[model samples]
Target: MQQVKAGGLPAVSTNLDAPKTRLWGERRFRKAAGSALLLCALLLLVSLPFALIGPSVERLVVLVLINVAAVVGLNIYTGNSGILTVGHVGFFAVGAYTTALLTTPPEIKADSLRHLPAFLANSNMGLGESLLIVAVISLVFGVLTGLPLSRLRETSAIVSTFGLLVIVNFVLKGATNITNGTKGIYGVPELVNLPTAYIFVFATIAVAFAYKVSRLGLQLRAFQDNEVAATSSAINPNRRLLEAWALSAVVLGLCGALFAHVIGAFQPHDFYLTLTFELIAMLVVGGKRSISGAVIGTLLITALVEIVKPIESGGGIAGISFPPIWGLTQILLSLMILVVMYKAPAGIMGSRELSLSMFKRPRLSESTIDVASLRAVESRSERPAATLATNAIGIDFGGVRALNDVSIKVETGKIVGLIGPNGAGKTTLINNLTGVHQPTRGQVILDGQEIVGWPSSRIARAGLGRTFQNIRLFSEMTVLENVVSSALARGHLATGVESYALSLLEHFDLAKLADTKSSALPYGAQRRLEITRALALEPRFLLLDEPAAGMNPKETASLIEAILSIREKFALGILIVEHDLHLIMRLCDEVYVLNKGEMIASGSAEKVQNDPKVIEAYLGSQEVRAARRKKTT
Candidate 1:
């Protein structure tokens, strides 16, 4: 069971049960389409009953659908990208104003926007034409605003977006000739009715669902869970976040355009904080992670608003009136949000999409890749070997040197061991080789290309994959997803990733638990999963940091066997940083020992084991030990 944190977002358990989508198949597309249609039908059913009551009720239903479109758009960014934004309604305002100015009659435009630029001043567009323009403009706006904020931490992103909100509101309020300031624009053509709203709402639902299962969406969620692991998988976090933000903006823009027409007229205040707060409340209360949650929250809250407004105005059911209750809707919403924060932080549905999990059929997806086909690729004649070499590479943190004049090389189809006592700079050297740390004074050459200062993601794409000293898994994701997401780094290879990931799982003896959440896996399995995920990058040289750190002798033996098979099958060069001297001595072809951030010995494992300097580093000098013992006595 997932626990909700104080802020209403689920804790570590949030991603434990995310729906797994089968990549590139009719079955997957069919399921998604069926789910969307089912949701649309439910909305129609709810709205139709209210239509028989009166036109006001029908209009209310239309408004609710528009809000659903807006919140679903917001979920694309705030939910998947894990950024809280108060500025989407700013895009809504942009859409509303853009549509109103473009679609209004030339006579109205001349009066209201006399100072408008010639290009915008003369054109009179229909609702459809105006909406098309609004979508493009909002996307551009989202990209521009989201790009700079993409790399920021959560608090910074929130502050930047809130500032964006203020800037947009300022523009709308001050651009009097165009937006007519606080007086608002009048005569926005009423082009959206119940039928039109229904069409757009369903369209939004379909698009959102499609995006949720897309490669981009999966990568975004991976970044959300663990940025470092995502980067190691060759996923560029900032670019993916920008894509989500822009796509969500397009949806919000479309909704805003629809809302403007439905209301027949609107002001800046109509799309300001009031609207922003309401939309955010809906997303949070419904659950930020699911599209269905967005729809449900919008419907429930819209009904609450309607119900409370009548009570606030002293209207009653069947002629039983009561005193006016000011801000009752807002008060009730606040209470509901508080309750949700404590009780069901993941919102109503958590990470689950609308599905048949309740029917108790098999949950695990069987491997679809032919084992023979995978083995055939693995058995092909080995390609030309690649090499990773560092020459006198050094890095300093402030005044302390983490790695000093460290040089190392690993050729394809070999295993090299990095061994040192505590603070001996083994991991630091690995970081330099893998582009995590820029060498202060030397060169990192991969396949003869100088990669000393490249970003980690670029280096990863250049055929370098590494695991962390501490196991870093996409804990909320299934084991299969962890591998498949990494495989997607190959671009067009995404469709075939599921099979490849399954093959990797099978190699590591994790085939049966492929559908299990990574967090739920046994310790050994999680470690194996991390290695499998790294291998998904298909790197020419793989770096394993403390792979056998906590493993028992039996588990280490299995790991050693797996490493041997991987080397023979893929012809990969492996660099392992481990304290398990026995496993290292058995598995590594060559061993390098470090003392005081300097390489002190390098040779065959047997030679290094007997080297006098290596022994001195491991067990302090005789004179030093004698002095220490004398002091203790």
Candidate 2:
């Protein structure tokens, strides 16, 4: 449902939403994901029938696969958490040496053990056991070291990991008895044949899939999107970061084991900074957010490298008998870099992933509607306007003065309004009630207990939702994406979001512009979008802050009507702050007037309008009205 205006840049990022669906829809997305998975498996099976074209080409493929696995693993930490870590190379080396030490042949192990420690010397195994042990042990190592270190700032995390890499290399170099002191290990068994290596690719893909759907991914993503907002949601950023870092390391460790067995001879020199940078480049060029992007990037870079290898002479173009150009390979790659930089810098796949929906390519049934956000809305029959206040309350903020404390007591909802001039703190009070702002003192009492100073997200969980005075729609994101993102934040990101969003859009008669980028909407539409997003949260108490900010008279009339319609549909207590007196007077069941940051009067709209203080502050008083009357007489 994402929509971009003509010639506007598409964000081109894939975001996975919440989980809920009818059995039929669940079956459909699952079928699509299953088919894509099956097709990829078939291609692998078909490709494995032949031996690699050349040993050089085979090596290139193996290295590319290793790099792809490592890159994908690194993304678990780097992509979702928004940290740039260079320490992944350290984990790669740890995995590499772990496999090498465990899988070397008995004779080679003994011969190399002149100065070895007892445990390592006696521990070498056959290929399968070594690979499995390497994966598990490296995961443990990652959790032990990487988790604790991940709590540091991004730069610090990278530097610390790099230090670990240096330390590991030094240890391997110094301990000739163990790790052969960097002379390198030889005679390691080759268990990863062509087909077995492809199997390793499947392992990495599985890891990617699990990581994407897990709770760790969600916490990390929330942290990446907005750390401040994430904190407000009570996600333990440090813990999530550590878990992702550790998990990524363990998955990369499996790739390292594959690397060790494939080549048979290995050295610490193989996993240096150069290899790390190349791995990062693959990720950047491929599109970081997606595992498939990592796979594609790995393939492209590997193929390019193969083409640049030295061709034995006697290769003459047009019988010139010309020799290969020195570093022509480097020059060619450099030119490709320039072209790619000049073109799509977001990489081949951008941030998009292979999704469950893309395979079926379902055109929305509600073509003009978002159709993805139905769970974010509520129905009117369950909620009536007059009885609204029993479920929802309002907040007032100003140094414990209790500016105004009231809850809608009616069983059927009624439209209640608060009217105040600038600086009257109506907006401040609204923020407190809706959990937007923590009060210096006051309970957002629901069911008679204090829900004071709760985070906006928690308050939102409690079903008191509000909108900002200035629109807070995801500006760069399209209209549907904006709403979808909000729903995901509310923990309802999947199939239900589409159904509810679609239904809500149709109900509000905004179906036609569903695909439009929200930022491009006209002022009135943007206002409506704010309300729509709020309604998406399915709140019982809806606090609207100046929903009529920039509308013309016609637009205002339409907006008022829309508000009334939304009220009936949602069956909620409605509290709004507005400068438009006539509309407020007409729509609000009761009005509260405030001046100088304190509530001064409360009554039915007619009585409040006639109150002396209200007249003096907003309408300029009786004497002023009398003077105008006399002038007219």
Q: Estimate the TM-score of every prediction.
A: 0.90, 0.67
lDDT of 1 at 474: 81
All models, RMSD in angstroms: 7.3, 8.9
lDDT tens per residue, model 2, 561-597: 7777766656667788888888898789888777765
Model 2, position 240: C-alpha lDDT score: 75
Highest-TM-score candidate? 1
C-alpha lDDT of candidate 2 relative to the true structure:
0.64
Once all C-alphas are superposed, what RMSD does model 1 give against the true structure?
7.3
Question: 379, model 2: CA deviation in Å?
Answer: 5.6
Provide backbone clash counts, one per model: 0, 33
The CA lDDT at 258 in model 1 is 87
Compute the lDDT of residue 371 as modeled in candidate 1. 34
